[model samples]
Target: MKFALVLVVIIGVVSLVSTILVANRVEAEYSKSVKRNLTNLTLMYVLLFLVLSVGIVWYIVGVR
Candidate 1:
């Protein structure tokens, strides 16, 4: 679960960053919506990565 979460978040960040860089040239309602969604998704991904990293470290320490 920890590794999966990390992969998911990294992918999300990369994909969103690419989309944002590409979408900057556009001026449309759809572009605005996509930007908004991408921003929110990226925040969620950072939070997930933080939580999973802490949880995994805690689990590992407890096991030993």
Candidate 2:
């Protein structure tokens, strides 16, 4: 359980950093449509991460 939680956190952090870097890079060259897409994609990723993290914590606590 500890390992799984840690792994999830690490993956989430890495994904977030990578996303931010890519978004910044693309923002410079892209127009409004592309920027909007990136923004949507980022929001989805954030929502997914939050859901997964909450589920995992809830499961752990319930198990205990």
Candidate 3:
């Protein structure tokens, strides 16, 4: 569980950094529609990470 939590955090951070990079690149090189889609996808990934983190914390607390 500790490992899972750490992994999730690392992945979340990496995803966030990548999203920022991609967003900047897309905005500069692509259309508004593409940027909008990318924004939505990034939001989904952020929400997923948040939910997973919460679940892991809840599990860890309940076990104790």
Candidate 4:
């Protein structure tokens, strides 16, 4: 679980950096760029849920 959390943190940090780069380069409509940034942020949410689901499965099997 600890390792999984660390992985999520790393993913989040990478996402933040990518967002910075994206914002710096794409100077189009602010609304569209904001939408793009949000879409990227969803990746972090996906990562968190994937880790949580895996941990739940692991607990079910290991603690059984």
TM-score of every model? Answer: 0.58, 0.72, 0.68, 0.49
| Model 1 poorest ten-residue lDDT run | 20-29
lDDT of 4 by residue, 1-64 (tens): 6687679768777877777676667656686867776677767667776887797788878987
**Which runs of model 2 end up more than 4 angstroms from their true locations?**
27-29
Worst 10 residues of 3 by lDDT: 22-31
Candidate 2 residue-wise lDDT, 1-64, digit = tens: 7888889889888887787677676644575766787788889888998899799879888999
- The superposed Cα distance between candidate 4 and the true structure at residue 64, in angstroms, equals 0.1
Write the residue-wise lDDT of candidate 1 on 5-62 in tens digits. 6886688778777866876767676886778877887787678778977987898889
lDDT of 4: 0.73
Model 3 residue runs over 4 Å out of place are 1-3, 27-29
Compared with the true structure, model 3 gives a TM-score of: 0.68
Evaluate model 2: give its lDDT: 0.80
Q: Highest lDDT, which number?
A: 2
lDDT of 3 by residue, 1-64 (tens): 6687788788888987887777677545576777787778888987897798788878888999
lDDT of each: 0.76, 0.80, 0.79, 0.73
lDDT of 2 at 20: 68
Better of 2 and 4 by lDDT: 2
**In model 1, what is the error at residue 38, expressed in angstroms?**
0.2
Q: What TM-score number comes out for model 2?
A: 0.72
